[model samples]
Target chain A: MKAEFAHYKKEELMRMLTIMQTIRTFEEKAGMMYGLRKIGGFCHLYTGQEAVAAGAISSLDLSKDYVVTAYRDHGHALACGMDPKKAMAELFGKVTGCSHGKGGSMHLFDVEHHFFGGNGIVGAQIPVAAGVAFAQQYQGSDGVTLCFFGDGAFHQGAVHETFNLGKIWDLPIVFIIENNQWGMGTNWKKVSAVDDFSVTAGAYGMKGSSCNGLDVLDVRATIEKAVAEARLGRPSLVEARTYRYKGHSMSDPQKYRTREEIDEYRKRDAIQSFRSRLSEEKILSEEEWSALTQRINTQIEEAVAFAEESPEPALSELYTDIYA
Target chain B: MAEMTYREALNRALDEEMARDDRVFLIGEEVGEYDGAYKVSRGLLSKYGPKRVRDTPISELGFTGLGVGAAIAGLRPVVEWMTHNFALLALDQVVNNAAKLRQMSGGQLSVPIVFRGPNGPAEFLAAQHSQALGSYWMHVPGLKVVAPATPADAYGLLKSAIRNDNPVVMLEAELMYAWKGEVSEQEFLVPIGKARIAREGVDVTLITYSKPIRVVEEAADRLAEKGVQAEVIDLRSLRPLDEETIVNSVRKTGRCVVVDEAWPLASPGATIAHLVDSRCFDVLDAPVELVSGEDVPMPYNHTLELAAQPSVEKVIAAVAKVLYREDV
Candidate 1:
């Protein structure tokens, strides 16, 4: 982060840092909890990709703007004003969860905050997010839609088709590609014909840019620019160059990447970097930083307790929400 | 009242809706500037301007997905696919996004959009293009599929579909588009999920809709000449299927012949036969008969395409089979 680029208020910077720490802590706990058999089924932790979700959502107004993401969406949901407790309860598949136990870790839904969905299909939410934006534009609302997807989803035909529509309609949509270098087991170089992702946006006649997803400030600035462009009746694309520390999901043994490579990303840990910078700049005192961590940890613990204590939804609930 | 063809009724509906609401728009290939391939969206561009009445590039998937986005954002979009045959390219957006969004969000959002155009076996369109896949959409939980037969129904149904809160797949028959009927000049809306008894009879009920509504009517007229008073029930909607009309009509006549333009095996006809058999078993004097499109890909040849779909002859045969059943 440049000295002159640091225009954010001290309290705001501290708040952003707390969000990063909270995401990191939450994901770390999720990974451990899943490993310890406390959490079951599929869980994809946003361990290394914390800054990407946290930084981008920091610039968003949750009331109007919407979010639709791929399966690696727990962190995105939490950052988009979803209560960490409900999000965790959702992960626990409890009735108190965000989706009332219907959707597990992959499908955390918080409609009140305008979080459209955590879609399970690859590249599926692109058009859905666009539709939400289309409705907003139709109703004369200036609300924008943030559609999140992985590097893997770039190959899908639906994404390209949606990009064309978004461009033609001049929809207020920011397509955030969390290009964490790898699409599950395949590397970007192997799958994508062009090494640079910003070039793909040019195919759809939309402006595209790349930012360091590991740097929270860089992501925040880039998204701020993209969101502004989208609000002006122009859709834009931002390819965040980040990496995931964990395997694709909780079940994987992570045989695809080397331990040394994981260690490399760990050295530039987003949460640690943001926390250290804020603390060193006197934006956050040591006591305040400790208190933020303590609060987040307590919140996670309480969420776990709530999920554990909550009863399962009745058998009839399965048939209740099928239609209007 | 004014006389209007089914296609003209569709165009009039769009013109009226766009006049009423600025948010209402039409988008598809040949819809604008070209005055629509089937001329269903004629004069809409001149009426609503290019922004609302858009003529999209030949990208059904792209434009349909765009319509989904636009609808979610609050636009009332009437997306025509030239014909439903081309909608296959945009099935991802239609099936995955537009249909699933409301329920996927647990009713947080509503897709108040319409994907409208002619469906069913168009002549010589071959396997890829010719299909009565309204049942495919009916298999989806969140969608509402409406197929209107007459010019009056087309006008009323299109008006209602545009105002619907959920995403609607509206089917118009290509052959029946030019057929004319009386339409009211004032505001008119036909309720969805309801059936209209086109003709009344007593001996047997001929259940059908869309393109086959005409087929069954001709069959009923031909049967009337043979002293067979066959009742004709036109199902306007497939999703919230009008089982009541079919069951009651079958109970009165004690026999049914379900005529569908779609293929056999789990089709609308098969499903209707199942419902009638299950609900009105005791009331039925004879087993329900089904007449459907051939259980094969529609051939490209003109005669083969006609043979592929359920003809008036087939419906007549089905009615006769139910009327004088050896098993009964």
Candidate 2:
């Protein structure tokens, strides 16, 4: 862990911790808001899957690189530097939200951040990500696209189709599968033919690998190499074996899993483990940890307040975005 | 003006748009290298190179979604399906993503993409291959559906679709691809949502578009022989419906017969019939009649296939009924 931090500057490592903590806090608040019926529509909390986004997104150049992900995307958007206020407001379905309240929770877009969107349709964003990469290559840009999807999206026909095109065209895109073990309520193993999702990447003529999604360092290091390869007009797939601490959505009863299984994954919580690792390396002191926590709490509170105070979209807005 | 085939007009539109906009590119199955599945995109690969004229795998969902993304990212993509039948596989991306992206993104993104291909029955092409999908697309809100009947409209409308800011679905008539008509060499554009009065008269109105326009014209010719001057209104754009032109024609003629190649139920003809009934009710002397394809899966047998779709005789009969000429 110390060796992983050795390559990164103290400030950069602190930023990573800040991003991960922010994502965790933000998701927790969003879950609470959904429970209060403040955030309508689908609310997919990315509480336990913070490392996958924090690790991978931190490696790319946000100015030029693009990102598109599935519905469980609050963590990814925050990781891509979307303002928590705007994201929370979006979940609240306010005019100030990133998508101007037209897209409730499943679709959050910030073109300024080069974050394409958070598509609600399962596996729909896969080929779109490939197109983004294709555009990068067409324009002769070195920019890469990071396409994120859940393990469930691996079964979609578009995934294989995109994989083939991405590899054949050598498009600058890294296909990231955040294998959070479960697709909605059903475990992925029951639905997917292959136990290993990365292995399927080989059939598409691309290199495949997996990373410990629990370790932010592992995700960052593994994705850094993949992003580098993609920048050189090569496409690759990296599966991050992670888990979601909550149900698939706000409405999910989560009857598929037991408490003990949840407990097991929580014991190796990405944020907690990373904090402990930093403490052992003397990179963060107890006082510094408390201060970071305080800062993150304030940010989350401010974001919630902003969302609460934001206005609902006007009726005229219904027709504005229907066309260009 | 030059006399060119409908295929040449479409090809010219693709060529001109590709030349006019650096961001515009073509992609689909056999669009490149193979010229086109129907040779509609002939010589484009050589003129624009492989980068602009892309040959895709038989992955309709893949490339269609890719085109949607590229459109959102500021590139105008022209994605040609081998035929509209094959486009059904990619309908999810087209209807859900491309159509809804702009509104879903709150106008942060606009999918300026054109999906063009031959649609409707072509000779003996059977059920799977033969389908008139204009009404299917017109049912979707965020889509602009265009079915050009002639070479000029094909050239003009295809150019407009590529330049439009929204997602446009251009459904071409497969049988009419080789039909030659005069098209202007000078740059021109036919605005969407506006219908053209192909042949004007006052006895009865023949409202139709795409391949069925020919049927209506033939019906008009025969109606002329019987001393009935029928007005012909070609509805180039389906979704917008061009209700004003349709209503005005119905007002003048006091009768209408909508001829569509699509099936009868929930078809574009039904939509027009409903519109004419509601808006032009006072002006109409008789109820609007719709001559649509039979409500059955297109048969493989040539005779059944011909019977399944609208014919010249059917349109003439429908017109005769609307005009109360029972002895025709």
What do the candidate models score in CA lDDT, each in turn? 0.83, 0.91
**lDDT against true structure, model 1:** 0.83
Residues A27-95, model 1: lDDT tens digits: 887887787786788788888998998889888887778887888988888888789888877777676
Runs in model 1 deviating more than 4 A are A1-5, A32-41, A139-141, B325-328
lDDT of 2 at B167: 94
What's model 2's TM-score?
0.99
Spell out the clash pairs found in candidate 1.
A130-B69, A131-B68, A131-B69, A134-B70, A134-B73, A135-B72, A135-B73, A135-B74, A136-B73, A136-B74
Model 2, stretches more than 4 Å misplaced?
Answer: none
Best by lDDT: 2
Q: Mind giving the per-residue lDDT tens digits that candidate 2 earns over B1-328?
A: 9999999999999999999999999999999999998899999999999999999999999999999888887799999999999999999899989988888778888889999998999988888999988877999989999988999999999999999999999989678989999999998998888899999899998899998888788888988989999999999999777988988988898998999889998999999999999988998888899999999989999989999989998988888788888755
Question: On a 0 to 100 scale, what is the lDDT of residue A289 in model 2?
Answer: 89
